[model samples]
Target chain A: MPKGKDTALMSWKEVPFGCYILESGNSVKFKTGDWRSFRPVLDKEKCIKCGQCYIMCPDMSYNQDEEGYYIVDLTYCKGCGICASVCPKGAITMVVEEV
Target chain B: MLKELAKFKGFSAKNLPKEEPFAPGHRACQGCGEVLALRLALKALGMNVIAVSATGCMEIISSPFPYTSWRVPWIHIAFENAAAVASGVEAALKVLKRKGRFPKNRRVDVVVFAGDGGTGDIGLQALSGALERGHDFVYICLDNEAYMNTGVQRSGCTPYGAMTTTSPPGKKSFGQMTWKKNVPAIAAAHGIPYVATATPAFFLDLMNKVKKAALVNGPAYVHVYAPCPTGWGSKGEDSIRLAKLAVETRIFPLYEVIEGKYYITRKITKPKPVEEYLKLQRRFRHLTEEHIREIQQRVDAEYERLLRLAECL
Candidate 1:
């Protein structure tokens, strides 16, 4: 079996006592980007990098690069378009996610 | 011994904290305001805190048995006793500090995050008891207005004329028969040190109120307006927009009560029509003109009543 797979279906002895999650912030392993029909594309030239996208995002998918540009980590972005809408510079555009 | 809290000047849009205490990944719908409020609350409290959440959308979405999104110390408790558990935690921490078991110099905030059902319905008794007994904790009720985790059933905090699974509007019934319970007012009535109302749309206001809640020496209650897009039949991107509209329309006013004195936080001079706010969410789509008028009247009366309270201060 794959390591760290869901142990709910496993035998009682194999499961951890009291359904305890030993590791913290382990939800990063699960990608939720597939759920969105649209994806936000950032315009580097137009982006002033106010960090609105980073602060307002429901999913903590946006990270600041070396240039301080708020970039989305697509693995965890749910594509809510909150950043696109809240951006004062209107630097983010949501395009149809290509399957 | 009561320690003096460090004064926070305030947070402007430009200078908000960069720390993201609530991690992302397990599952919350696109543009969930509940998670947004939760994240802002944790940011305000910072890392020196222990959060206790009830069985609701946040607890279910963030922790899925094997995974967790919390970076700080967290405990998941039953649906009704979040406040009860939080009080016990506060008492234990006090004892531990007194006995020299825990560090006396370090002050850790104990916070409770619960939904409307957990705070206004099932958990009201325990919350009241904690408030009356003066527990040094902050209880944030993420009011999505329904039992959203269990597929949007109506709760006591659900507003009138809004449709939910159990309170669907039909030929026989007109959505929820009762008005949204004023839980913040109820908390303030306990004569607690701090009580406030906030929404995710106003990030600065929310963070300030939450931080103040932690600063107070006694129990503090912050009722946050948590918008549920999937449950309310609204577009995913419209969640934040809807939250803003709800406040502008006077449906959810932002204010804080400190020791029985009311202070309006974001005062709206020219309020929008309640119908404008209602039209965005399909849950209120079924309301007729009469229903809209009724809702508007109620909103005006409530706002006026709050204005009267704040006027004295």
Candidate 2:
């Protein structure tokens, strides 16, 4: 976890189980058997690089590399469908990854 | 000694769990009713539960990046797939339980939450599929009339003669020309184990219905009338009171459909005029006297039908 950063990507298992904590806390710990990650697969053939998926993602999970093509960070992606919904062309799909 | 023993055995508010599964700090609008409904639903479901929310106001506001309002295991799927996701979760849990993957002594309940646009419109098909499959889960529709998350667009659940982005009232036409879809009746037609219509104004009754739905082994549906202050153009603090007036005016009746039987939970002995409910919100400000009369007649007819169903029960 980075210092002074309120939100950091961590496994769900690191958080204490059955404890209710508000989202305002700077640090988060997950519980064992609770961590799940969602990976975004972008088809290069269908990629128009419109940046709609990158812009619409609420989690800011996607980023543009040196080539200007968008790539998603699976470690932090919550798998909400703002990207796919806003994508004019069918370009994005959320795939659940094994923890 | 006997009095002290009885006191210990009796129910006390303090004995109830104080954990809030829906924590504060989400970006729900100042007076968003869906947020209140989520809070109350969490209070009913407790900590040992997972919530599947559809794409709507609650999902967007509460789940922006590193912030999430939910204290429970929450999943946000597509706009019209909350019930389907909940069904998958329940099925997975069942398989895990059978395979000893989950603790045999403990069980987890699944709840699906969706807004009116997602539930009454886009998600109805998926919801019906889940109910028909007899998935052991609770599906709650926090109906705020229109698609408030999408800039107050009119949805099928919007009431007649109400202004919306899509159903704007004009010189030649009334707002939302069509009447609101009868979603509770549609759920009742599924012949599910339990179905009920509730509102935030009646907190105890709403919680009771949620508890009953949770205990049922098969599919259960709870439609909650959540007043939207921003969409309805009303005072934010008046959300709960307006919900109460909706029931009093007989516009949105409080009732339950259990085991193919209809039970009217809150019956207005002397129903107030429909104007009393409409006059509170600016969305219905364009309704003329004739339109108000028409709306009242429709409300009376619906109330009569509900009364008939109760009688048959």
Candidate 3:
């Protein structure tokens, strides 16, 4: 389903008043990853693919690859270090950004 | 560092599912406790839910102009009628499903997220009405204990002896003279299916309570201890620490009432003094040692009463 700008393109009268989007799952337009001061780097060799990062991330930044290994989607990751803190095997490391 | 290590049990993270209905960005302050609670609550509720938010901090921050942070179907209505709006939505969904207008497989959970002022003071009537009518929805009170969105005014849930903008400490008076309202007990009195108190510091306990509330057949109430750094005069980073201390000091115990039976979910085995919780925030700085002792005694008495209720039940 079309969302964001397309929904905004629709007639104002047609859509419900008060900033109501016509469809769900439309938060992609807002990039919040810039809010991060630290970025998480995964040590794939030691990851064990427990899917801990995928499950525990508050931002839902982790996705499973075709081989079922979890990868961080940095587009929306605020780098809260929750995934790192929750990783039992210590496979994830948080790197401070130079900026 | 050891304290942080002991606070989190890593294994519990494995149980959480990766679905972000409440996205980051928009306009929450750094380390916002209410936003954290909303994130976790939405995580537990998943994508198949409709959230009705009252006109407060969450609503203002999430819905501005043509932008929204909610990835799910969300509504921002008046401050006092989120429950009413949710009840309408649930009723519409029910009738639509029964009349075959909606797909048979479609199951949408209706949830209301309101602040302490909205839930405990302004919206109390609508909430009570909905709960009494037994709407199949969850009413979550993000109890930050004051009117945070409107310049940090005192509310019904604001604890006794805390300084707010309106309840400022003066030469002749202390701040917020009355005790915090026992909202969970009020919800339980309606004989609802579930009523619980939770905090974002205890992720497992909070998520579990939210999940249970979402699945219950009747009205379910989950009061979350959402500490507001801006209102409480604490550092933004101390949000989680203050929340943990609130629980640890027995000021906000984790408990649930299922059909009038009380169950203390998390016990403070080695409880700290209320001052440990109060000293961190400037809101309580004006309080003297005598005032602190009074608050401590009140907390002890309330906790003991809760324990007795749990034991008797």
Candidate 4:
């Protein structure tokens, strides 16, 4: 588990139990990329730049470069293969990660 | 086919908002479908909304002590009163807005996120009251089928013939004897403006329904089909596959009701047998061939009934 924001001033043991609000942007510190066992590699040659991969990625890990094609951010990608499944051109393939 | 698929053509990561209302790092199980649905729904709802979460998996996991995954203003209510709390929030916000306490240009959406136990059984009365009173809020029931947080006890939404802690199968009886409750249909029966069924397997559809539900004037209900790998005894990685199978098999049809009018979003052209779905979970592992056939018949009948409802409008 990632350390929450402002742990010095507030702690789980100290806070009163009930309904209370937390500051925004606390969830960004947690990275889910380690959950990936299979990573998706994009073949630019077969890619149509149709943006289907970008749309279907649940984690929003796809980033569009200056050339207008999308790139996957491996830091947060969970390797769900949704992009590859939804890709009409079959440009993306899921490959097993070498241990 | 091209024209039919064109509706989703331009959607890209660039189009999505930069803000992350519900953050990661809370203690949700890996590949948890309920968390996935919550993420998509919160993404669609954006930063200007307030959420009331009922006591369940999400509530327990997201807000454990000092750490919280929510970025927006969220309230953790009881297991059966999220709708009531949200209604109160909406009413208070309305009066505050009238008194010029808030900016005239701003609109704060009141939303509820409850599990199947909270919505289908414990929270039904409060939910019905909120909807009947015409509260301007979006109520989302992330149905994971049973009381997952409380050691997998069977709830009202638990489907027939599935084994749970309280509904184990034996020589005299099969698991949970009743069918899954149709919470969305009950919501529509209240004449709410929007009532939709969504699954995390279809991210875009779930996002669209959440957005629509947020914008409705009266009460809106979005019943999301969230599969629980822990309780269902399935591989964590196969969570999305299990959800997709549920949709493809037409066992949990993806549809919506707009002011009593039904619309089937993703039509199952050639529905697969329910056994394909049942085989994915260990809860149904004890089911015999005869039991599977019975489940298939039940699914087919339900699908036909949904089709008829869609045709009525």
User: RMSD per prediction, one decimal?
Assistant: 2.6, 16.8, 7.0, 5.1
Candidates 1 and 4 compared: the better one by lDDT is 1
What does the lDDT come to for candidate 1?
A: 0.91
* Residue B310 CA displacement from its true place in model 3, Å: 0.7
Alpha carbon deviation, residue B47, candidate 2 (Å): 0.5
Candidate 2 chain B — worst ten consecutive residues by lDDT sum?
Answer: B1-10
Per residue, candidate 1 scores C-alpha lDDT tens digits across B1-313 of: 1233355577787777777788878699998989999999998889999999999999999998678999999999999899999999999999999999999989899999999999999999999999999999999999999999998999999999889999989999999999999999999999998999999999889999999899889999999998899899888788888899999999999999987888899899899999988998999998999999999999999999999999986
RMSD of 4: 5.1
lDDT of 2 by residue, B196-305 (tens): 99887666677777877887778999999998888999865467668889999999999988789888999899998989889989999999999999999999999999
- Models 1 onward score TM values of 0.95, 0.74, 0.82, 0.84
Q: What are the lDDT figures for the candidates, one per model? A: 0.91, 0.77, 0.84, 0.84
Residues B1-313, candidate 3, lDDT per residue (tens digit)?
1131234442255666666787655567655778878988998889999999998999987866556788888878998999999999999999999999999787789999999999999999999999999989999999999999989999999999999998999998899999999998889999888899999878878988898787667889999999787899986656777888899999999999877888899988889999889998999999999999999999999999999999998
Off by over 4 Å in 3: A1-25, A32-99, B1-12
**Candidate 4 lDDT by residue in tens digits, B1-313:** 1232235332234576556687656667655778878888888888899989999999887876456788888888899899999999999999888999988779889999999999999999999999999999999999999999999999999998999999999998799999999898889999878899999888778887788777767899999999888899987657777889999999889998877889999999898888888988999999999989988898999999999999977
* Between candidates 3 and 4, the TM-score winner: 4
Please give the C-alpha DockQ score of model 1: 0.75
Per-candidate DockQ versus the true complex?
0.75, 0.02, 0.21, 0.26
**What is the lDDT for A52 in model 4?**
64
* TM-score of structure candidate 1: 0.95
DockQ, model 3, C-alpha based: 0.21
Please identify which of the two predictions, 2 or 4, would achieve the higher lDDT against the true structure.
4
* Cα lDDT, model 2, residue A19: 41
